[model samples]
Target chain A: MSLLVELSNVGRDFDGGRIVAVDGVSLAIEDDETVAIVGRSGSGKSTILNLVCGLDRPTRGEVRFEGRAVNGRAAWAALRASRIGIVFQNFFLLQSLSARENIEVALLGNLGGARQRRVRALELLAHFGLAERATLRPAELSGGERQRLAIARALANRPKLLVADEPTGSLDVQTSQSVMSIIGNAHREFGTAVIVVTHDEDVAALCGRRVEISDGRIRSDNRMTAMPTPAPTLRIR
Target chain B: MTELTLPLRGLISRPLRTLLTVLGIALAVAGFVALTGLTAGVQHSFASGINENGADLVVSQRSAFNLVSSAVPKSLSSGLSAVPNVEAVSGILLNITTADDAANIVMAGWPSDSFLWKDMHLLAGRIPAPGDQWSVILGESIARALDKRVGDTVELQFQPYRIVGIASFSSVLNQNSAIVPLEGLQQLLSREDVFTLYEVRLKRPLDKNDIAVARTRLIAAAQGFEVGDTEQFSSSIRIFDLLRAIAQTISLVVMAMASVAVANTLLMAVNERTFEIGVLAALGWSPRRILRLILIEGVIMSAAGGVIGIILGVLTMEMAAKTNFAAGLIVPYLSGWSIAQALIFVFIAGPLGALYPAWRATRLLPADALRRI
Candidate 1:
């Protein structure tokens, strides 16, 4: 498959070079690839993800999306809106909106009208098996439910790439398993290239390949022996 | 969905804050309407008085800035009448006094047979007779204020006069006034040969050219007199102009304060929803879209406030028109133009208030914002 994201000699420094967040890191993510970036805290896994998502410019070297260099804030913003989707560790669902409305917000900047937006939101919620809780707000939903809703919102625009920054960090073991399976299923069904950053071995084991980061550099890059297939359904009932 | 429901949901989530912000804008807009209305009413009264009376010219003492202070010799009336094209000329004496309170009550003295007196429709009782020295005609407004009826004795400046009639004048100046015989009031004020002003009427359906020629002739014939048509008469009043300026200044200050209140509310919303804004960015909303969202919030709040304020302001003006203080002298007028002006001000102010907040929101990067708790 064609390379979807490519980073060449990318380096990001903070505090006037006093701190090296990500130094001389080069990586390539191909279309429909499910890759996990595993690292301990302060190992720059999140920083690398930011570079790949075009949210941050490398101080030196280049970040390319679809073979074009992510040059400026405008370029990065365009890519994020049309081609890339991100899920946060905290879920980051708008607290004021219901589960359905949160997903609708993603579709708002698109060309469709209100009715089309509503249809898409409902469809996404149904896919996540959270249709019954569509009217409930983020605070009203359980942690696992919130994560699933966040994922649904991220996929609202049918993005080609899905970036999850510790997607299951806030969930319990059983809830984490459910959330990871949902992400895997989305990657499989939508043919979206998935890049998940996590320190947990269980979360890393679910991906087809794993890249380990340590001390602002890639420590190891290896393929998994067996890819863990996502469960068919995660029905809360 | 985002244009209508999403911003509304954001505002509804914080109901109390939205309410307080809307209320602040409402009060400011109401204050703006009421203050301007009072001045507009006063100006309207003067113009309506001269226009409705069908008088072509008002000949007051030269350099006199107000009606109460003007003094023209009664002899000027004869000269004014003799002017070519002059159909009739009438003399009037006016003064301002406090009845029982500080509010000024205009007292006008008109010739018993003059057209000025004829113009006032007597609501009850008869006007003073030609030789009646001790009779007074009360305008409807003054009658209500003094609580006097027909045949009741009203003591004016310690002189008791029998109330012969109660009248209603559409012109605000005459509405809050008490009228008496020209000779009687002249004797009372010890200015028998002098009058406050002269009302000159031209031949019926006179063209503008005819009125202008007559106006010039009257001015040339009467020395130390200012002969002007209704338009000049209304514009020459210094007090009306001053009141309008004061009203404008007050309205501006109130509008500025309301804008500040709106800005404060918008800024708070941005601060509280930083993470949500970040998520929106991550989901594909551009900085411009985020800016529009915040600005729309401000616009919605201001527009809602402006509508409520307009209703309240109209009601307040109506109440003022009925009050003793505004009776005769002023009827608070809220014109369509003024209402439109208030709305336009709010619409502009609302967007201006949102500018800084929207810019601040746009500056929030998704990467940095998501990092914050």
Candidate 2:
């Protein structure tokens, strides 16, 4: 697999000189890579996720998608729209659009036409077990259900890289496990670079590798032992 | 399936709010167009009247020259007719007095056979011939006011004259006059061979120099009748002043009200559709595209309002006009050109109203917006 995201000697400052959001961070991930960032609050795990996803620029160093130095904010913006898809910690689905339409927004800039985008959005929703809730708005969904819709939105661009910022942040333990399964299924099926940022050890254990962060810098980068697989069907009804 | 449908569906999701905003905009545009249209109609009527009266120079006796009441003697007409560049001399007598015993009655008299009444149109009935000495013509306004019709007799002082015609004239000058044969007027006014005003129709339209020459020849012949310069006539200035004052007043109010309405509605829309707009930006739509989308929505709303308002205002005017509201109620005329003017106002006001709100919407940062949404 080829390199898809590389952040070298990256530093970010917040609140002027008072806060260092990310300090001289260097990270690289390859295609078909499944990695998790585990950090506490103020550890800059979200900042690192942002930089990798092209939603942000490093104050002092460079971020590259493939080998091209994604040239500051404008280029970062272009990549963010076309090449990268991000699911925020808050599950930031548009309140007005339905679950299906929220996914469709991500496809609009990439697809051929209206019909194809709706079909594609529907297909993605079905993969997340949300085909029946296609017409439901964000408010109508459960926390786990909303997170699943966010996952569909993130994949709308058919992107090479998927970045999830605290995907299970607001879910109960069982729902978090279900979201982890869904994330794992996507990573294995698509063979895409998947970077999940989380505060939970169990969530990080689901990834192939876990990188721990402390005080805006990396503390450890190591492979995590995989968790035992849960039973099939496993309907929590 | 396409990306573009996302924005459209999102916008249309809140149907009631979207419709209300559109309606607000349309009403602003329509009101703006219709009011201005009324002004345009009035100006056109005034100008058309001035053009039809056939006066290159209106020689009013400077001493007592009220625009509504100007007249000259018969002897001056012959003398003014013989002036060097003069083509024809038409003497007119205007005795403008409201009836003491009745409503707003105004009595005017001139030779029915002459070209004076030639420019006048009979809306109903025939002209009062000199032979029909006791008959008079009804001005359009007078017909409505006196509720008099053709073949009905109307009173002037104690004498009754048959209403031979109902007519419309070009000018604000004598539009409401109750007209009769000149010989009958001489008998009533107790004057012999004496007329009041002279409308100096020239062969070629007189410039300032030509008018001066005509004035000099008139002063040279007539006694105590000062033939004022043509340029000094207050018709154009009065109309212009009244038009400017009214236009300034109405436009200021309409533009301010409409612009504020447009800005308020669009700004609210930007807030309500926050995430949708952010989604558009996140999907490679430019700031310009976002601004354009908002403005297009605004324009559609305002234009719809403009159309409905115009239709409403016109219908109101039609109802008022059925009973003969004055031609220039504001300037005394309500006409077709007024409708066109109102629509043009709608077009202009729509964009102007959308400008600020559209700019504000386009300036939002996608990251910041996403957080809020």
Candidate 3:
């Protein structure tokens, strides 16, 4: 497998002098791999996802995406728009536009004609069983519906790498299952490199590998030998 | 040239705020444009009123606002006529009188064939014949008000006069004035110098010394004599200038207030849509593009407001044109130039007001914007 992302000795400091967000953490995710960062709040799990997605520049070391350093604004912008997809905790869908427009808007940042983008947005929504609800605003959507829309918007650019920060942190357990299932289907559909920063053990269990962070440093980096089967049983019943 | 569709969506997302801010901007620009329009009209009318003379000097009673009681003896006209530098002098009496219906009208008595009548545009009918004492010339306002036509007879205070000719007005809403023969007004006004003052038409413009030389002779011939050039006549031009300054100052203040309203509304919008702006930035939109997008939002608001205001002003002006309108709603102005200037003012103001707010929106870091989300 090819290396999709490599975070080399990344460290981040905040609070002007006192607090450190990430402490010299180094990690790599291979293409087609599903990785989860599990930790408590502010344990630098979100920070690691942010750095990998090029949302924030590291204070030390380097982040390579597809084998190139992205430290400047322009470089990060290109890396994120064409190569990466980020899903946020709060389902950051623009409230004014419809769900389809939310997904269609992402096409403006990518390479395609208007008609093609529209067709693709519809296709993605239909695959998620949300074709009927594509015209609805974010305000009209449920929490699970919002997370699904966020996932749809993230994949609009056809990114090779997908990074999510607490994507299901605010949802109930049932809705969280629905969100994870939807995300799993999307990851398989696009052959994307998936990385999720979450606290839920079930969410972490769905990923092929889990990396734990403690006080800004990685404490565990291990692969799950056997994936969970609770989701399949719930779907059948 | 930024991707403004997203920013525009942000603007409409909060419709009430957008509407209020846009209205505030429009009102300001309207106030500014309308006032300046009036100023331009007033000044133009005054200048046109005096300059309409092809005359070098206006020989009237000094400082008299009206010519009704300021008549110079008719013999002064003959004396001015004989001066060496003066080519011709026409004595005219302009009286503001009421008809039996109590509507105000201007009645002027001058020699029908004199050059002064030539200065007045003839909309209809022929000039009054000599000894044609009972004939009248109605200005546009009086003609419309009384519903009189050429060959129609109107009852004056003393006698019935035929509406022989109609005189053109500088403005549609200008007061109505009539023209009759000088002999006719002497009888009605009951005075010998029924002619208010003589207008001296000079053969050529005067140099400084010639002006001084002409000044002495004009005063000796006609008492209360004053002379003014085409550009320096304050009596006809200054009132409009003062009015114009007042209008200009008003528009400036309104523009400032409008700018604040626009900026305030945009500032709120920027803060509220921070995440959206960040999203666009994350999507590869440059900060400059984001700035332009916000500025476009401001300009669109300003433009919408200006269009509403101009429509209102023009409608008000048209309505005033249709009625007697005792107070002038349509001031004397250069309409085309004034409206053009007003539009330019709005365009510049819209962009200027949006500058700081757009910059603030652009300054928002993408991560910071998505922080809460």
Candidate 4:
């Protein structure tokens, strides 16, 4: 697999260097790889995810996507538009848009014409099993449904990398398993790279590789024998 | 999806704020239209009244602010007539007074032999002959307003005059006036041998040079008087200029207030949607796109308001024209130029009011904004 994103000794500081969020963190993500970053609160795992996705600029070191340096706001925005997708813990689906429109919003300007975008958005909704709730707004959906809608929106532009920050932090165990299964399915179906930042150990156990961070530095990087395929259906208690 | 989808949805989500902003802009635009329309109407009526008489030149007192306040000696007519190429000269006196059941009635006094009387079309009955002291001709509008006809006695300033003719003139102001014999009006107003102005007519088949020469000669003949063509004379009315200035100033103030209201509403919307905007930014939307979204919302609200305001203003003027207070006096004149001016103001105000808010929205960082709960 080719290297999709490489962070070279990235360091991010807050409050004018008085507080260091991430220090001397070197990480590399490969195409079609599912990696889990595990850390406690304020342990810089989320910061590393932000730097990888171009959502935040590092105070030191460089980030490269496809062997080209990513600099300036315009460059990062272009990358995020076509190459990277992000899913927040809260889902953050636009309340004013319906389930289909939420996915359509991300496809705008990056996809084909309006009609094509509509068709693609409907297809994504159906793939995520949200076809019946296509017309429903985000607020009207359940927590699991809203998270699925967010995931569908994230993949609308056919991005190469998906950066999810605590994707299932707000859900119960059963719903978290369901959301994780969808993420694994997305990786398998589209061959897209996945970087999930979470503190839940069970969530991290499903990935092919695990990286543990402590005190703003990587403590252990381990690779499992294989990435376990998630169950197709949620199992009750 | 089109670029306008999100902006349109944002406005629809907050219907009450959108509605209030539209209403505010509408009221401002309505005030602008009505005030400017009324002033323009007055100016048009004044110019039409002068043009309808075919007067080549008008002569008024140098110190007078308007024709009605002008006082030139009636003897100037003879000297003005002696000027070379001068075909005819007519002297007139004008007054504003309350009559029975009518307020602010325009009373025009012209001699029976004057050329001014030639343009007054008699709708019914005969024109007053010379030496008819108590005879008067009522304009069609005032006749309809007072419900009077030929041989009906109407009292003006407690003096009774028998209506000898009902006449219609080309201009609305003239149509709303009452014409009387020159000497009788002088006797009634106690200002005999003094006229408001003189209307001069040069011989026909005259070019611009001939008129200029005649005007110079007439100026030489009538000293201490201002002489110009009908257009210049109409534009020189200080009262009309003052009314137009006041109307424009008030309209500008109202437009500024509306712009401020639009700005405030947009600022609040931006604040409330900070997280959503952040999400859009994170979704690969550029800063320019976000700015455009906010500006489009403002412009949509303002455009809708402008259209509704124009309708409301026209209806208000039409209703006022039918009221007793404005009967025969207020003629609402809505010109295409005035409507375009209102629309231009609305369009300019839309973007101007949204500029600061749009800039503020663009300044929000995606990471920081997403952190905002």
Candidate 5:
């Protein structure tokens, strides 16, 4: 598989370099792959995900997307808009927008017109079993439903890579399993690669590869020969 | 679904904040509209009064604070009329007095047979006849305010005079004025043989150069007096200048406060929506788009306030025109130019007020913003 994103010896610092968030990290994500990054709180697993998604800039290393070096805010924003999608732990859906509108917003510059965006948003919502709740605002939705809406919004542009920072961190076990199943379905159906950051071993086990980090540095990396067990049938309700 | 949807939703979600901010801007714009409208009305009335009288030149006391304070000797009328190209000259005495039922009524005095009286189109009754000392002609507006008709008695300065005619003039000032024989007014005011100013009419077909030459001759002949053409005299009224300056100054201060209010509201909104903004950025919305969203919100609020303010100001001025204190004194005139000025101000203020907040929103790092609770 071709590499979709590559990070070389990336370092990030805060407070004028007094705090090191990520250090000496080099990683590559290929097309159609599933990778899980696991670490304790503040171990820089989320920071790595940020670098991979171009949400945060590295202080000392080069980050490349689709073989071009990402150098400016505009370049990163363009890449994120067209090629990368991100899901957050808190399900950061716009509270004011309806579920369908939230999805439509992601398609704004990437899509042709309002009508096309609306039709596509509806299709995504119906695929996620959220068609009936398309008019509901994020505040009116349950935690799982909000997360599903967020995921639908992320995939609205059909991004090549999905970067999720603790996709199931705020959900109950059953809901987490259901969300994992949906993520697996997206990977299989869209041929999209995913990078998930989490502390849960069960969540990490669902990915084809696992990378462990400690003290802002990668400690271990492993690739399993066997395909991750097929996710259980998704129960959207 | 459109570009405005998210920003509009954000504003609608915070109903009270949006309303208060709009009201604040509305009040400022209203003040601008009302004060500027009143001042413009004054200038218009003064110019119309001059232009309507068919006066080519006006002679008044030099450096006088206002037309009411200007005094020129009635004896100068003959000399002014003798100036080359001068066709006729009329001496006028002006005063302000309250009638029994009306306050702030303008009283203007002209000769019974002066050409100035020719401009007054009598709607009813006859003009003050020669030797009629206790007769007055009421402008249509003042007649309406006092509810008096021709031949009815109206009391001015504790003295009752018969309304001899109901007349209409082009200017609002004249329309709301009471016209009397110049000698009768001079006798009443105890200033006989002294007039407020002299209105001069040059021969028809005279160009501006001829008028200028005649004005110079009049100035030279009537030493110690200022002689200007109608346009100059109309524009030189100190009270009109003062009113305009005051209106502009007050409007500036009010607009500044409104801009600050808009900025404060937008800042609060940006602060409250930091997380949502981060989500937008993460979703691939560029900083420019985020900035545009915030600006659109501010502009929407300001534009709304501007429309509301214009309506409020017009209504307020109309109401004030009917009040006892302002009756016959203020004519609310709202020109298209004034409305356009107010709109331009609010439009400029919108982006100006939102600029900082939008910049701050753009500066937020998506990762850091998403980290917020």
Candidate 6:
């Protein structure tokens, strides 16, 4: 399997080096792998995800994607836009835009025209069982619905890598199961490299691999029994 | 959605604040239009009043501020008429006095035999025969104000004169004046040798060379008097200069207020939307695009205000044009250039007011921007 991302001795500091957020962490994510990062609050799980996704630079080490260094801001932006998709913990949906419009925003530079973007957004909403709620804004939607909308938006551009930070942190246990199932389905169906950062042990159990962090360092890396599921027959329109 | 739609949506989300900002800009724009537009109109009135009479030069006493106080010797008119290229010369005497019940009525005295009298069209009755004593011709507006007609007697400075004719001049400024014979006015005022000013007409088949030569000769011949062509005469009016200064000062104050108001509104908008801006940046919107979004909001506000301001200004100008203040001497003429200037001012003010807010938005770091979320 080819390496999708490699971080070697990565360290990130804040407050003029007064606080170390991520320190001397080395990891590699392989292509088509579903990895979960588990840690306590402020244990640097989110920071590690940011470094790997090129959202932040490591202070004293290197981050490589597809065997090339991710250095310049422009290049990182292009790489993120073309190959990686991000889902925030808080959903980060534009409040003014409807569900369909929020999803279309992700397809802005990737799609050709408004009609094409709208069709793709509707297709994603239908696949996510939110087609009837396409015109509803974030405020009108439930928490689970908003998170699902965020997921749909992240997948709008058909990115190869999905990075979700605490995707089910704010959801109820049942809604969290539904969201994890959707993430698992996306991973298995699209063969997308998935990296989810979370503190929930149950969430970590859903992934095939789990890496636990403590005190800015990886404490353990374990692989659990993966439940093989049938791939989703529905494809992107 | 297009990049510009975000700002539009923001504005729509806060309709009240957007409306107030627009109204503020509207008032500032209206102030600019009213102050400068009316001032320019009055200037236009004075200029057209001087130019319409076909007079090439005006000779007034040295250091004279206006025709009301100018005192050139009446004898100068005859010598001025003899200057080469001079077709005719007329003596005009102006006195500020009460007529009927109105105060500060302009009473002009023109030579009855000169071309000045003939230039004014008689609307009713006939022009007072040359040298007719105690007879006056009322301008159309003065006639309406004094409620006097031909054969009706009007008291001028406690002395009654018969209204022999009702006349109208090409310019509104002149139409506001009541005319009497020059000699009659001098006799009545007890200043026989003094006349307010001299209007010099040049021979036609006239060119720029003839005008220049005539101007030079007239200036040289009138040693104790100031000679000016129509353009210079209009510009020399002290009231016009004062009005222009007043207009300029009001424009500056209003522009400053407008800039502050617009900047404050946009800054508040930026502060309110800090988190959203972060989301946009995280979604791959460039800093330049964020700056453009802010500037476009400011411009939309100013432009809406500008359109409303122009409408309000035009209505105000029309209302002012009907008022009798200064006896209707000030005419509010709305010119095309004034409208264009208002638009230009709003355009410049719009972007200038947004510059700081836009820059501040661009300086927001995406990571820090997410902190608000």
Interface Cα RMSD, each model: 1.7, 3.3, 3.2, 1.1, 0.7, 2.0
lDDT of 1: 0.83
Query: Per-residue lDDT tens digits of candidate 6, residues A1-237?
Result: 799999999998999999998899999998778899999999999989887776666788999998888885556666666778788889999999999999887777778988898999999999888999999999999999999898888777777788899999989998888787777777777777889999998888878899999989999999885624533532333
Q: lDDT of model 2 at residue A58? A: 72
Which numbered prediction scores highest in TM-score against the true structure?
1
Q: Rank order by lDDT, top first? A: 5, 4, 1, 6, 3, 2
lDDT of 3 by residue, A74-143 (tens): 6777767777888888888877788888888777746467777788888878766678998899999988
Top candidate on DockQ is 5
- iRMS of candidate 3, Å: 3.2
Q: Summarize candidate 1's per-residue lDDT along B2-56 as a digit string, tens digits.
A: 6877678778988999999999899888888988897888777766765666678
Give per-residue CA lDDT, model 6, range B1-373, as digits (tens): 6655678899999999999999998988888788777887766766677676668888877656664666888777767888998999887787867776563466778776778866778899887886686888887887887677899999886778899988887777677767887777888788788777778999989998998899889988888677887667666666667877888788878877998888999999999999887776666555666788899999999999999988888777768766655554667777788789888988989888998998898777556677775
Model 2 interface RMSD, one decimal: 3.3
Candidate 6's displacement at residue B242, Å, is: 4.4
- On DockQ, the stronger of 2 and 4 is 4
The C-alpha local distance difference test score for the whole of candidate 6 amounts to 0.81
Please give fnat for model 3: 0.29
lDDT of 2 by residue, A23-105 (tens): 98998888777889999987999888877865555777888888888764445556766777777777887776789888877
User: Chain A TM-score for model 2, please?
Assistant: 0.92
Rank the candidate models, highest DockQ first: 5, 1, 4, 6, 2, 3
What's the residue-level lDDT of A150 in candidate 3? 85
Q: DockQ scores for all the models shown?
A: 0.63, 0.29, 0.24, 0.60, 0.74, 0.40
lDDT score for candidate 5 against the true structure:
0.86
Kindly list the per-residue Cα lDDT of model 4 for residues B13-125, writing each as its tens digit.
99999999999999899888888887776667666776677789989877467557888897887799899899889888888776675555778888889988777799999
TM-score: model 1 vs. ground truth: 0.91
User: Candidate 3, after superposition: displacement of residue A127 in Å?
Assistant: 2.0
The segments of candidate 5 whose C-alpha lies over 4 angstroms from its true place after superposition are A14-19, A172-174, A225-237, B50-64, B72-76, B79-87, B118-126, B129-134, B147-171, B187-194, B200-232
Q: What is the TM-score of each candidate's chain B when compared with the real chain B?
A: 0.89, 0.64, 0.67, 0.91, 0.90, 0.87
Report the poorest 10 consecutive residues by lDDT, candidate 6 chain A: A227-236
